[model samples]
Target chain A: MLVSTARLHSVLKTAVDGIIVIDDSGTVLVFNDACVHLFGYERDEVIGKNVSILMSEDDAKSHDAHIKRYLDTGEKRIIGQGREVSGCHKDGSPIPIELSVGEADTSEGHQFIGIIRDLRARKAFEQRVRDLQSNLVVMTRVNALDEMGAAIAHEINQPLTAVMLYLQTAARRMKTLEEQDPQLLSIMTRAVDEADRASKIIQRMRSFVEKQEPQKVGVNLASLIDECVELVMLGHKNDNINVISNFSDHDYNLTVDAIQVQQILVNLIRNACEAIKDCKKQEVYVDVDIAATDVFIKVTDTGPGLCEEVREQLFKAFTGTKRRGLGVGLAISRSIAQNHGGDLFVEPYVKGKGATFVLRLPLGLDGADGQSNLASASMI
Target chain B: MIHVIEDDFSVRDALQHLFTELGASSCTYSDAESFLNFLKQVTAKDCVLVDLHLPGISGVEVIKYLRELSDPPHIVAITGKSLAEINKAFTGIKRPPIVRKPLKEECLLREMDLGTALNSA
Candidate 1:
């Protein structure tokens, strides 16, 4: 049976959504007005070329693989499901669209009719809503954390200051009375050292909570790891957790935001403390290894590691072990790592053991070196 | 003498220690209403470390009430509230000072404005 030309033309042109028909050879056979406006493609320009002309390089590569399976096996994965695809416009911008393709076998040859829905507006609206929600959450958390930090700092500093003063006075008195008793002098010296350590820890936490812009420097990851461990330990003075570091002597230097490194370390360290809670002997181990290409920061804790159920949605926001946190710490850390072309992950090394989170980064990703690579990759 | 108006007990105790160490007199109040009731029978203090977010009247309102006095204490609005709140509440003063919370001992002394206080004395 043969369909009338009028009926086929009506199906192609009078459809509510955009529809386009192409021959087996990939020449555009028909174009509707919606397709004309949705994309800046005209009938004259598109009627003679390959479909790859309207797709991004990445999209085109996948499309080639997609067609190869269908042409050889006559099997289809997306013909009925309606796949989301990218369509390149006349101005070289890729327009996001959902495509439903139906193959029509006529007496003449094989023709594919494509129905496309433009998704740009819908996606933009969805993205706007997400951004608003994210911004609101960040703003609220930032304010609360800021205020809480301020209170903790102000209130904690007073006694600390008093302690500092008394220690200073005692130190001077002990010096003057050294001939009277050396034991008292030794005791005063010990007191002074303890007070100083306490003060330093408080200062570090106070600074961390306030979150000044990090000291940007070219730092050796191996050395920085040692410093960060000591700082993290200071915050957990009362806890039984012992943080041990295993490192490679190789220079693992990178120009990065140091405060960010400290922030992540603190977060992981805190989590490690929580993980090892109630264990006989709590331990948090850190391994920093620098290979020829990458540097690694692995934080391992003793608490019953990541649960199998939680593993599926592990890195998702709002899923945290702590009741008080927003769970953005790990999420933010992951984003920071990925944005710098690094990777962050919770690695399940052995079953029924402590948890280990690994952060891997390139040796160098800054300034002239990074910019040139990004530019060349973009061009290609 | 100094009055410390703070809600947190630990913070209030901490401030008391700070004032004692500073060689100043101190009276503590958990909220504004209690502080005001005590102030009616007593005279103005030498300084007050007032928290902005109080249970009853705000820290800024307390400052306003002090401003209405014949002799307002050297009002130093020390707040652990947000920078925005402290900035808005404890601003545009020629005498005395505003100290941001997590108060450094040095900031407290600096804000005491000893030079101005001595001239007035």
Candidate 2:
């Protein structure tokens, strides 16, 4: 029996976890070799002292009350459960520890045995994993933004190319005229203004992708939709898709991140174009409406509406049905809309044909109380 | 003579006016097919200014078709698109000169003048 007990003691002392036994009065009765290593305290130093010395001041103060309460109520809180708590080393420095306690009815009296696992290594690993995950997300976003910048360049270049030609032509004509007629001068001025407008469009597009912060300003809905159409139709020439835009008569002006909002529009229009690619008579209609406290832009496509599978996970990331490129466009677009105090969602597919995406943005002087209705209502 | 093929009416008109300003007589065609038709019977020492994008038969296709001719005109491709975007068209034939638009008058004039000098040489 003595040899067996000695073997058991050796096993407990050499275990990975720090083991401690305390009497019902909270005084330490046994401290394993692991405990000594974990706390930087010698076995002799902790064996006869209160177990509270191993805990920080706050935990130490509450240690006695916990034992007393468990003793009086016969209730087990931490006795059977593992909890995260700080342990005080011999040098008075605090370290994180995962501790689990168990109650034993010993011959001397009731004792509490605790198994403590040091959390430093595990915590460090978790932090590293978090850092790597965030880095990956940042990399993916950068790549996406880079592709978008190229597309924006192509889009803006078309108009700028036109601007340069128009202005140069006007200058040549002005030189040929015997005297500068007011009408001719006015036309030249207007052409220059048009070129300036094209540059401004490019500037807005560059700023949108380059700047991290959203810049909010009052924007006219008509011009924004026109810009979106121009952007989507830049490279595509042969695929005959009729895009019709209906804007509200009131200008539907609102204070919001115009560039980001334009991105959402561009994404929706491009999606519409992709959807109707197969149809002989393809059509995408964009309609803007200003409600009492909100503005709604609906993009309707005459494509084979969303199938059962696609409709179920419409706004989910990487769920797009496009054959080429990452499907993060809609996901990122919706995020931008939401960030600008708006919402983007697909209305239900009508039975006969067509799919509608409703982009609802909050509109008001304060712009705080506007709420988007999340109900998908296009089933009929 | 400079033959301009561009689908965009305004761009084509502007190029025509700019050519006139630079003291060069130019003819404008809206698409590649009309220019190709004209190329079949026309005999002239001319340079072709073709836009990359056109309604029917792209500018690249026009270049490919012209390559089969005994005496193809000196070709200059005017485009807003990057050269890489249209680089595939120049695979088998002698690559034509490229001019990126919005058209710079001096660059265009110099390219045409160089082509003329090379022809005379």
Candidate 3:
């Protein structure tokens, strides 16, 4: 029985954990293999040394008092139930550990045994995950703020210029005429110039926020729709939900903001997926048809049609029906379409069917202005 | 005569001084309620320069209130918030004029049909 007991003790010593035993006088008695691995000290080096030697500065200060009290008063504090404690490694890294200690009373007096579970790796991983999540959220909010800054730049730029021209005209008139003809010909002109700068900044911001690789070269509506659907599926689609796309052959291209267009498609697809979450079919259908004058891409979800309330402010910013999101997706999408001399609309799907979002852009990509589509093709 | 409705202190402060300097007779209100109260009593041949976004009430409602006036002056929706809001303001009132800000003196002069200051309101 004594030999078997010795064999079992040796087996326990090699197990993956820090196991330690101390005599009633607090002299070291047992130190296991795992303890050596954790502290980077051999048994011969640590077995006779004081336990406090293995603790961090803060841990050692309190541990000194704890052991002194137990020895003096025969009172137990943390020597029974396991408590989370910090351990200091040889390399000076702090390791989190759960320690359980108990006393073995014999004719001589009592000894204490401790079991410590290391949690350094797990805590490190959790911290890394939290840091990444925090960074992602911060970036997304900044992107939204930046996007609005751009939108305002476009709208305010023109009137600002006209205002400036009026200023210069008034300045000349003021010198030539008697009365103050809005002393702002120069001021208005400056405001317009500044507004133009603001618009450029806005465009730059949009480009910065969505810096994903541009799908340049003549991209057809069919291919764009497919790409969008694929992206949505990666995030939201699953075994229960499927998406079907029907695209028409389009031979033309638009001098379009392809990144902006993809953004719209993603929003629409996401909106559709969210809409049909609990429906039976749980499928979203995207149908693309290219006309001689326009290109139409419609997204239909099997979910119930939009309620009366959602229909009212369908394309308004901040005021949207989505439960999760900036509610600016559709609003931004609509604006991009409008900017491209195109339009995105919400048409009644089938009377009792789902919602249909249609995107229609003018034929020939360069129609938004006299600007060449060649510029767009390069960016694409 | 014009009713200046705005909320952003910095922008509104500049507008108050700008309109006063430009020689347009005006009253300034920081909130929709204060402006509505003043507009109710100030019955005259005056235009309204209102921000589209305001605290307590929307600029759209302000437009509706002006439309109900017995002799409504031209309501010019002035804002620096968003183009969508400007578009909505125009569409809401069937093409009402709008001026967006930094409050340029010439834009204000031209939009308000202000002739030479010698013919002050």
Candidate 4:
């Protein structure tokens, strides 16, 4: 069954996407109703005008050249592909559009049919999702900090109490001493050491809890892992879990939001420690390998390996197996990984062995999609 | 005698130093498990200064166990935990005199002496 020209015209007019056909010289030949609605222009007004009128100034300037280049060289730059481009609306505002161009050699001349889809609604929806995700990440951090604050206070107070006692004893001994005694000096030295210990705990806590916008910077992977391990081990001191880390021989510098990456590492390492708590062989192995374009951090535990059932919903939010947490750590960690153009996942479970969680991150922030980076940057 | 039950080695050693400086006999235990094992030697005349956040058997459990004894030792609760947490842990049980961490020597001695006096009464 052959469709008439009138049927094809009607089909183009009723199409959801805007359809516009332009000649090789860049003059708009046919503009359908969808195109009229898309650019706020009538078909009659656009049909005889150059298609450059619907493009931004920069794209408009290169519009004719691009078509001429393809025609002259028979090179298919965008003619056979789709890309996101900026289009100028009738009101002179920029609009994000998905453009796909198809070439046709007709009886009259060369024609390029461009299928354009308005991306305003989609971009707005994406922005909302990103905002919600950012908020959830902050909330997760605050919740974790709240629980950690208690433990930190307990940790810091132990040393603080020791410092106070040591000093008090020294003061009493000094009151009775005829001269400066070596024993009192040793007591004073111990007090100073305890004070330094408490200060270091506060410093680590401050770095973890300080609220800051996400900004990518160069970070040493080995140092970051060591810091996270130390922080996680503070709470698990009595658990007797041994954490061993190995770094591949390479430049360990990578661009990342350090605190955010540390958050993921802390969650992973802590989870590993918790996993091996009940096991006879309690060990957590952290390995960092830098590949050609990406870095991989793997955390392995000697606990009971994950079951098929537990591994299924592992990254889903609010499904934590632990008794205390809201179970959003893995979910938030995965979200952070994806936001960085990376991923977090568990390896295949082996019976009677242990589980390994892998975090893969790009060496550069260029891998992240531009829109999210722009949104995060503007949010600050 | 003042018995110090603390998990941290520094705090345990400092408490021993304080007891020696004050000329009071005292013994220190690293955790609740070890302290409980030595409970057979404790008496009503002795005062126990126990940290609530211990590994293994917890200080609250130790206190409860001591309270169940016919001649329970005088107990002083020493902790870095907040009052609310301490209260929650001691729910429905008689709580001992609570001492906060970064402990003041005077306050701690006062509590220990008060506990011993009450026990011997």
Estimate every model's Cα lDDT from 0 to 1.
Answer: 0.66, 0.73, 0.67, 0.78
How much does each candidate deviate at the interface, measured as C-alpha RMSD after superposition? 8.2, 7.6, 8.2, 7.4
In order of TM-score, best first, we have 4, 2, 1, 3
Instruction: Arrange candidates by DockQ, descending.
Output: 4, 2, 1, 3
Write out the backbone clash pairs for model 1.
A153-B102, A154-B102, A154-B103, A275-A303
**Tens-place lDDT digits, model 3, residues A1-380:** 89997996886677787888777555677888889888887888777667876778887777767877888897877866888888888788777988899878866667788887888887875575455345434644554565555555544544543444444444444555555546455665565567556545654654553453223334555555666676667676345778888764343345455556777777788888878878888888888666767778788888888766677688776776557776776777786676555789888535678898998866664454222334333222
Candidate 4 per-residue lDDT over residues B1-121, each given as its tens digit: 7788998899899988977776677889999888888888888888899999897898999999888888987889898755445665787888899887767677787788744544443
User: Model 1 - which docking category?
Assistant: incorrect
Native-referenced Cα lDDT, model 2: 0.73
TM-score winner, 1 or 4: 4
Error of 1 at A24 (Å): 6.2
At residue B35, candidate 1 shows an lDDT of 88
- Put down candidate 3 lDDT per residue, B1-121, tens digits, no spaces: 6677877655555555555555566677888998887766644367677877686798888888888888676677776544554563456357567766545555566676444221446
Considering summed lDDT, which 10 consecutive residues are worst modelled in model 3 chain A? A371-380
Evaluate every candidate with DockQ and list the scores. Answer: 0.06, 0.19, 0.03, 0.49
Error of 4 at B91 (Å): 7.1
Off by over 4 Å in 3: A71-76, A153-316, A320-380, B1-121
True lDDT of residue A284, candidate 4: 93
Query: Chain B TM-score of all predictions, in order?
Result: 0.78, 0.81, 0.80, 0.89
Candidate 4: segments with Cα more than 4 A from true spot: A1-16, A32-37, A40-49, A61-77, A117-156, A166-352, A356-380, B20-23, B38-44, B67-73, B81-95, B114-121
